[model samples]
Target: MDLQAAEKRTKELHNLLNKYNYEYHVLDNPSVPDAEYDALLKELVDLEETFPALKTSDSPSQRVGGEILDMFQKVQHHSPMLSLGNAFNEADLRDFDRKVRQAIGDSFSYVCELKIDGLAVSLRYVDGLFELGATRGDGTTGEDITANLRTIRSIPLRLNEQVSIEVRGEAFMPKKSFEALNKAKDENGEEPFANPRNAAAGSLRQLDPRIAASRNLDIFLYAIGDPGETGVRSHSQGLDLLDDLGFKTNKERQRCASIEDVLQYVEGWQEKRPHLPYEIDGIVIKVDSLEQQDELGTTAKSPRWAIAYKFPAEEVVTKLLNIELSVGRTGVLTPTALLEPVKVAGTTVKRASLHNEDLIREKDIKIGDSVVVKKAGDIIPEVVNVLVERRTGEEVDFLMPTHCPECESELVRIEGEVALRCINPKCPAQIREGLIHFVSRNAMNIDGLGERVVSQLFQEKLIEDVADLYKLTYEQLISLERMGEKSVANLLNAINASKSNSLERLLFGLGIRHVGSKAAKTIAMEFGNMDKLANATREDLTAINEIGDKMADSIVAFFEQEEAAELIQELKDSGVNMEYTGARPVAAEESDSVFAGKTIVLTGKLEQLSRNEAKEQIELLGGKITGSVSKKTDIVIAGEDAGSKLTKAEQLGIEIWDEEKLLEELKG
Candidate 1:
């Protein structure tokens, strides 16, 4: 076909596909069947491949994703993405209403929206064409994630009208999408995300846009960045304008004329929340009038005109059937409460971590007692407290086992520690747990080596240690239950691939005491090889920043063990790469940069750079970024609305630099 015909057909296809996508994803109504949409999409792809120039940024084909990005660039939001103050109960909501009435004389209404449990993002459009999308990193500055955001089908690539605008929204993974993603992860022996919010955030932050596309993300545009530009008089109108412009807005939002009406709406939703496909942690109440919002104004961190009424954690009473003890990779005996199955926070709870014996004693928890259970942060199930009033005389006091349940070794509490630990090196439970840890996502990252498969391997005596994993043959694996020819091949390939991982993976997989993933990377980067790290003295280990005396002692102790040496030899004999392969950190003394040898702490919102960008630049110049304010901190880079960290630094007489000053120094 000619260029003109191709361009015309491409535009037609874009309109059709976008219309179908809007119906299917945003409106939850598809005009065409999946097969029809797929065929049309295929045709569009073919046309784009044949006539590349016809493919524009707004083309429906862009939703499939683009080239992988090395890193996300920093973006400055037009206006700060201010957070909202939270109202935990009805009293707090009334207090907020009182404050609003005092400012606006009770003349304003409120727009109540479901507080979507997802990542907050900013979308920008120039002349009604999608331009850029960013994260709400520190409010003032954010990371440019346009490529990833384009993959969400609900997000319109082009507006209905030719107008420049910016909007704020929640980018979310629906409950169904999150379930499917977790299911896939579980099948691949990967750790599933704790919640939909985490899954959405992880998906959007992926370096490859294709990964985000595969996550089945959705969005709800809530507010206009500059409502005045669109001539929208109220927040409710802004949402309507977003809908008119072909943007997805939450239809459940209501403009309440009175706080009583708002309270009723909030109450109604609390009961209906779980039935929805998406998660909402709270209800956001915003004064409807733009003028009233401006009058009420904002504080340093959050808008005073708006408040989020968080749902109280749903608590349920369940009988604690028994307490089960399990040994961890570190040999600590952790007690878990086995409870009668009860639903809390949208999921069923069968067991909750008791943490240690101390917690059990402190809570006065006993077997067969009625316990109040709740999900902490709406994710982890925990026994909030014992329902003493509901408990019967039949309740029995639980006792801590004197010996390890799996190994029968005597349990001893380490000095300065609360939990009882089994110190036996040859404990089967510890060995099994260690093997599982060794092949975890952050460790060796063996794809097909899940807990079940590892247990089977251990039980069969085909693999006793992490090193034995590399020695597995296809024939042996194929004989195991659920291990077909393809599955065995994939497992063997995954095992072989893990052998070539950098020294950090190997070091972390080893389960050395006090050496976490970050510490392992630092140690590996410093020594460059396993043999050098094995030979390093306590003092040698301690010389590195972030490696304290305790960690150094632990490292020295770990390497000095005869079994550790033997394990290393076995791994080496299995053709495992022992050298660090990641980028090396620059030596502090090597550069004359101002940041060299300085320990810096970043606080609050940076206007010019994303937190990561600033951190990368600082580290590149040999400065270390620590999380807290301390006497050890050489400098504090204070950004807008700097908080407790800045005050602490000031009290400590630590040198402080504003974002401007920091930027000046960086430029120099």
Candidate 2:
């Protein structure tokens, strides 16, 4: 298409996408299939690539996210996004009601709704289009996550009305989506998200919008940031406006005429919550009238206008039948409790993490012991306490293995840590673990290769070390049990693709002691090359910010070993990136002024720059991009219907800039 035609088409695509995004995210009514939406997006990408000048910040393609920012920008809200006081039970609710009645001395009504178990956010709109999004940071400032917010299809890109407004709500993962995400994580050999809250928070905070998009996030607008400004007189009126403006709001809201009715609503949900598709931690009871809300006002941290009536924690009892052990990719032995099947938090509890030998001994737990199990943080099954009085004589103490359970190598407890590891680098279990770690999602992120497949590969001796992964053949893979030709080909393709991974990934995959993803990134950038890092003294290594005494010692020890040195050399020889360059930013020395000490949050899209480029620009300007919004934010760069973050920023009276304005700042 010609430039003019391309520009016109891009504009048309933007409008169409905006309507669909609003319909789906805010209205919960999808007008198109996901596949259809994806196809349109692909077309837009192609058009933009062919005619770069035709792109704009509002384009749907720009929502995939940008590079990591050195800092988060601070944004002050127009009004404080006050926290709600919590009511643990009916007594607390009655107390709140009594306090409200005493304060006003008039008959009052309330709106009772589900308190979604998710991260709180604020969204701001100008002229009916989303302009900014931010977190509820300290009820004052917040982080900007425009790009990440755009990836949430449930979030409207535009509003139904032109009035500038702020809405506060929750960003959440539905129960079904949470389960699917956790299952996918488990299958990918990654740690499952602990709960719906964590899952939502983690997904929203991802630097990559693609990662956030994959998690299936949803949101619900609860209240307007400035209800009086919107000409809405009550909490119920705000919900009506939110609904009319195509904003997604929870449907379980009720107008309560009395405190008794509010209590009834809360009690009803306590039993009905499990049947809902999304997680509801409690019930939020709000004074219905804006006049009442203002009269009620707030405390330093919470609103007298609102209260979260919380439910009792979910816990169940089960018997510990036996202790089981699993070998990690690093050959670290972890003990787990095999329990008699019992229901806890709506799921059957058959096992729980014992943490380690120390925990088992400290707790004095044994087989045949009755244990109280609760979903720790409402996600992972955990043994909270042992019912010592119920323990029978049949219970047996679990002994820590003297050797590696898988390879039978003598185990040694590493000093200053809980893990007992097999020092044998060449041990089959260790090798398999190393390979799995190398290909894990947080490491090289090799798709299609799972733990079971890696185990089969090891058992068949088709490969060794991470380097061997690049050398696999279809014939060898197809020979394994349950391996079809297509599966084998896909695995090989994923391995081949992984060869292009940057230096940070290689560093993480090496699995050095006292090293994590953050540490690996720092080390990779500091030394610039694997060989240089290997030769660097502990003092030299500790000079980096994330590097410390324990980490340096571990890194030095890892490099000092001949086997590790050989493995590094082998990986280098096999085409893994051993030098850092692809995405490292210049030192804090590089451009340090107007942007200095500034924290900015980027949300939605910037048509003129890649997400990475935007991040680098912000850092170069001496600004930091924080993962979440908080009181420390300086500015929020927003795009589209930015959701609760924008609401938060407005509530805090934070200044917001659009993509066009942000681009100008970066360019200047």
Give the Å shift of residue 32 in candidate 1. Answer: 0.7
lDDT of 1: 0.88
lDDT of 2 by residue, 1-668 (tens): 68888888888888777777765555444456555676777889999999988766557777766565555566777678888778897889999899999988758898999999999988888887777788888889988766677767667776667878888889999887887666444333345566789999988777666778667788888988888787878889889899888788886688899998998888777876664668888998988888877888787888888898887888988889898888776666778899999988778889998767766787788888999989865667888788998865888888898998787889987655566777776788778888888889989898888898888888888887777887787777888888888887887788877777778888888877657776787778778888888899989987665466767998889889998888777777778777776654434456555566676776655677766677778876767765334455678887764544565677687778888988777667
Question: Candidate 2 — what's its lDDT?
Answer: 0.78
How big is the positional error of residue 321 in model 1, measured in Å on the Cα after superposition?
A: 8.4
Residue 97 alpha-carbon offset, candidate 1, angstroms:
0.6
lDDT of 2 at 422: 73
TM-score of 1: 0.54
- Output the number of the lDDT-best candidate: 1
Report the number of the highest-TM-score candidate. 2
Please give, for residues 127-207, the per-residue lDDT of candidate 1 as tens digits: 999999999999989999999999999999999999999899999999878877764443232445767999999999999
